[model samples]
Target: MKPFRRRSLLAAGFSAILSVQHVLAIQLDLQSTDSIKAAAKTLAGDMVSYYTGYRPGDVPGNLPSPYYWWEAGAMFGALVDYWYFTGDDTYNAITTQALLHQVGPDKDFMPPNQTKTEGNDDQAFWAMAALSAAENKFPDPPEDQPQWLALAQAVFNTQAARWDTTSCGGGLKWQIFAFNTGYNYKNTISNGCFFNMASRLAVYTGNQTYADWAVRMWDWCSAIGLRDAQYNFFDGSDDNLNCSQLDHIQWTYNAGTFLVGAANMYNFTGGSQEWADRLNGIIGNLKLFLKNNVVYEQACEPVGTCNVDQRSFKAYLARWMAATAVKAPFTYSLLKPILEASATAAAAVCTGGVNGTSCGLKWTEGTFDGSIGVGEQMSALEVIQSNLIDIVSGPVSQDSGGTSKGDPNAGTSSDIGPSDLNVGEVTTADKAGAAILTVLLIFFVAGGAWWMVT
Candidate 1:
């Protein structure tokens, strides 16, 4: 063979091998969309059962009370999304029931005091997100739905009112009671949730203030929170340095929340090319982090370089990555591999006995051997399933509808009385309180267990 021809053949052979490897790594049976749907359905069902059965109240016994609320809200939101995509009324009914149980007339809305739980701001984000999903699904405005809107608005106001311009360079305070105490610091997760909720509220109310807050929060994150040089996804504090020293100590939820927030902003703003470019950059970095086969080990920082070994970060990353793929513009071919890999990895973690239907994956590390926490499982499944829905339904046209605005009356609801504003102390000694405490403890242990295992 001629030297030039030989070289071309060699290059072609190498490219073929690479393509085969990529296909094998993904391990998706393209012919088995039914299997994928079934797996997602089972996972969603298990998650709803776990949250409703194990963690029923907002009290700190096992997991911190605030954590439970956050997870519950997130799970409900995901379930609502799932219903939206799959047209599964079961998921919808379960999610509505769960939200009513948590935020309905008789439930404790905030976490107990002395638990060191961050304020219910995270729940506010979840509540607002879920409400948005509910509204999107059922166009007819509920007569009593005004109360739900009022509750979310009250939470948003409380969060906005607690914003601190000092120390952290102007971001929402993490914990309301610990304002400026310096013990509880400003972190990306809180701000991400704040931005996400604010953006949603802005759309719902048709108000620009909430939209402005969302943009400002994004600016704060991009400017101060992100450690671009070292590949750190978010800062633990607003005043932190830009160096990537924190890269080794990455948190899955932090990255996921930030990406979702960014995606939400992009969706609301009618597809800014800059936002799309930034998301692509982040997506590239994230995929590079996943070069290693193990999800948990891929992003281990200071202790190990990125993409090293098995770690629990995959659950959170998978959920967020799926969220990004679903909401943002991306080629189906690019997303198909990721969706398959994420779903497969999630399935491997199922502790609920993977007989195709009843088994569920553990969202965090310490979940009961057979349990899948509501938030983790629901978010993960929602991300994958929602993307699948979009893929099947066809790409969303940029001009389909302009970004929805936040509710105008979101901040000034007189119906949110004084009682709704108070975040009482944690007292779990009573029977009802003990039950809440037990559930919280279980979630906490599961989260701690996942953290340790990862």
Candidate 2:
């Protein structure tokens, strides 16, 4: 069948499977169309309240209490993804506003006084969202707004300088500066983010340098054993720079971030066999994260102990699976079962809105676990939006509705809020309060067994 004919038929036939496709999606792409549609409906309804905590007008520095730049960045990245996947412009402002608030004068992302909290990894997280904005042309900012593409490039430039070739055959460090203990740490996330960003930038710029960086980052990651033969990514080896002594810990995002990078490199290389092998190997390794075909934070949460960060990790894995699935038809069919189950179950976990419409963590249980917070809401949003990508782009003959030619990311775009508003100018008292709040995050990062381990 021709592409449009297939898409049109799929569009009309889309209604055929909503209530019944979950079981059949494992066998066919047409069946999963309904699953994605069904999942998108629930996400559209809850997105407003789910994002209420992160808006700029309401909170100090325009962030909710227990502010985390990295998590907020990921949340915004997911929202931009939703906009691109569905062309729903309602989310455009929120994603733009929140991100603009963080882009300082340097084009580097640090939300003002919270500099102590963000490392190279944290900044990369925010930059990841910016890159998504650049790739998809989510929305053009209004006149007198930050140029999303330039901001993303500024981030890449900063990261490129920090790519330490001296360390274990070359990779990025966990911290951008030396003040913190993580400065020398060559972790999966820092380099994974670099790999992902570089891969994406290569596609956006048609720049061979970006492509080279992507290849180099992945090679180093594998050489260091951070990405092992099985393609599973371990947590960072602490500050040694030797790239030996793989920490051997696992997290959904560590492995997940690398997959998208690999996929992009595959696409950029015009489907090179080397990148293809890496993509397939990475996907095969991700099987360890599944339970009965549903994705989970496998190493944690089964014992009722997913900490602040781990609770949200699987969302990224779901996201990249759908993002790259458009390029890998085989991987799409293989991965859609988990996406379908995750979207349905994740939607069913909501129970805390004005009348029980919000979502919570522990989505696999299909019901709220008596907890409600920003991280859980962010996680659910990521996967729910993820399903939309699969619906429009996965395993079907359609132009990638989510992206286009020549990186249509020129000119400055406006924001939803005041452009000049800084993130936080903390007073002594606010610093004290933020200090207490930062403890939970610090403990969370230090692995109260939280192996999303940055």
Q: Identify the candidate with maximal lDDT.
A: 2
Per-residue lDDT tens digits of candidate 1, residues 1-454?
8999999999999787655533322122334765556656766766555543233332212223223445556555666556555566775544544444344222223333323433545455455544455345332224443344444565676566656655446675455553223224566666776776676555455567877888888776666645364335654552333222332345555566666556655766777886676666655555544433323333343244323112223444555555556566663355547656555555544533333233233322322224334444553465356446544442222133323222434444323332343444544455467677756764664344333222
Candidate with best TM-score:
2
lDDT of candidate 1 at residue 115, scale 0 to 100: 32
In candidate 1, stretches whose alpha carbon ends up further than 4 angstroms from where it belongs are 1-33, 53-67, 104-121, 131-135, 138-141, 147-154, 179-183, 201-207, 227-231, 238-248, 292-320, 331-336, 348-376, 391-406, 411-454
Clashes of 1: 32
Report the error of model 1 at residue 35, Å.
2.8
What is residue 95's positional error in candidate 2, in angstroms? Answer: 2.1
Predicted structure 2: lDDT: 0.66
Scored by CA lDDT, what does every candidate get?
0.50, 0.66
lDDT of 2 by residue, 92-132 (tens): 65566667666764556754445566676788888888777
Per-residue lDDT of 168 in model 1: 47
lDDT of 1: 0.50
Worst 10-residue lDDT window, candidate 1:
57-66
Give the Cα-based TM-score of candidate 1 against the true structure: 0.65
